[model samples]
Structure formats: C-alpha cells, structure tokens
Target: MCFLFLFSLPIDTSDRQKSLPYGTDPEYFKMPTRQHLQASSSSKVNTSAKYHEKDDISSDIDNELSVIFRTLQDLRNLKENSTVSPRTEQKSASEKLLKITELQAAIGDLKRRNAKQRIVKMPQKQN
Candidate 1:
C-alpha cells in the first residue's frame, strides 16, 4: 500500500526513544523538563517561561478608553471656566492661557493617578 506508507515515514533513531530532542539528543538533556533548560541551538521561545501578553482592548478600544475619560473631564471643566471668568490676567494672552491651564491640571493629575492603578495575573503550576 504505497510501499507500506512510504516505509512508514522517517521513523529512525529507535522510533524517537522517549520523544523530545529530534535535535540535541543527549538523552533529551537528562530530562526533568530538560533539567535546567540550556537553550542555544536556535531558540524557539522559552524566555523565562514567557507570559506577559495582555493588550487586547478592542470593543473599539473600549469606547476609546471612555473617550479618554471624557476628554479629561472636558479639559478640567475648561480649566475651571477660565478661573471663574471675569478675566484680566494682563495679557500675554492671559499668560499663555495660564500656562495652558497649568498643563491641563497636570494632565488631570495623571489621570487621577492612573485611575487607581491595579494589576493581577496569576496562574502557573505545571510541575
């Protein structure tokens, strides 16, 4: 049958001893998950057990991160309605628009300190 399925495919080295290591087979580097994985002969991912893959976001990038938090709370309420109107900051175009409203209120205080930062990822135990 097609020359016994082409002589049953490559099948050599005593039908791959106990798998793994069709490459640097020194008894698959003393296996215990290749005791101390010494990568060299051309790597293929294992950079410290790789895993830091979080960035999906699409739901239209979560409604564009809530329209960039409603355009930084409408430019901090248009810089507190230009410091409650009744202007007169003796021009220089009102001190360069009050230094662009103190740099947009320090970028709305770093988006309110990164909107209360939090990160959690857990899951790893395949030993």
Candidate 2:
C-alpha cells in the first residue's frame, strides 16, 4: 500500500517543459517568463517617461494661457481708461474756461459802472 501511494503521488511536469525552446509549445504562451516581465517593465518605463514629458508640456501651456489672459485683461482695462479719460479731462477744462469767462464779464461790468459814477467837481473862484 505504501509503494502504491508513493507511485500515485502527482508528478510535477513544469521542469520538463523548461528545457524546450521558447514558444515551441502552445501551452507556454499562457505562462509569463523572466524575459517577458523585463520587456514589459522596460516598456512601462518608456511610457512613464513620455507621460512625464506630456505633463510638463501641458503645465507650460496652462501657464502661458494664464499669462495671455491676464495681459488681455490689462489691455482691456487700459483701453477703457483711455477712452474715458479724455472726455472727463475735456469736460473739466471747459468748466474752468466758462468760470473764467464769467469772472471777466463781471469785472468789466463793475469797471463800467464805476466809471459812470465818477463826479466832476465845479471849479471854485480863486480868492
């Protein structure tokens, strides 16, 4: 009974298949080997490197776009200020000119009234 049980133990056939050339059998396709693992790992490294470059480029583009937007906003503000500034300055200048003209007219009127009020004294006989 002992010998029968020993002979009936399951045999490991994996060592026998290792001796065959790679890809010679269809069943080995499902199993992964060291070379396959290394190849996949190397490909992953290359893909990660490319991804890092893509991320850097995207970040640079985002920064540039933000800068462009800020510049455009500043330009718009400058345009608005430029358009409004001249009108306000012209209005203020006209107001000051009007005030000066009014003052001049009032002064001339006062001078004319004073000139008309001057009294002439009669010449007295010399004794």
The residue-by-residue lDDT of candidate 2 on 17-125, one tens digit each, is: 6677765876655778899899999999999999757544323334544655665465445422355678797875686567557656655655544444432234566
Model 1 lowest lDDT segment of ten: 50-59
RMSD of 1: 16.8
* Residue range 29-127, candidate 1, lDDT tens digits: 664545345454225454433431322221243455566677657645653335643555345347656766865776675554344332323455698
Top lDDT prediction, candidate number = 2
TM value for model 1: 0.21
Question: Per-residue error at 19 for model 2, in Å?
Answer: 99
- Model 1: residues with Cα > 4 Å off, grouped in runs: 1-34, 38-57, 76-127
List lDDT for all candidates, in order: 0.53, 0.63
Candidate 2 clash total?
Answer: 0
Residue 22 in model 1: shift from native, Å?
42
Per-prediction TM-score to the true structure, in the order listed:
0.21, 0.29
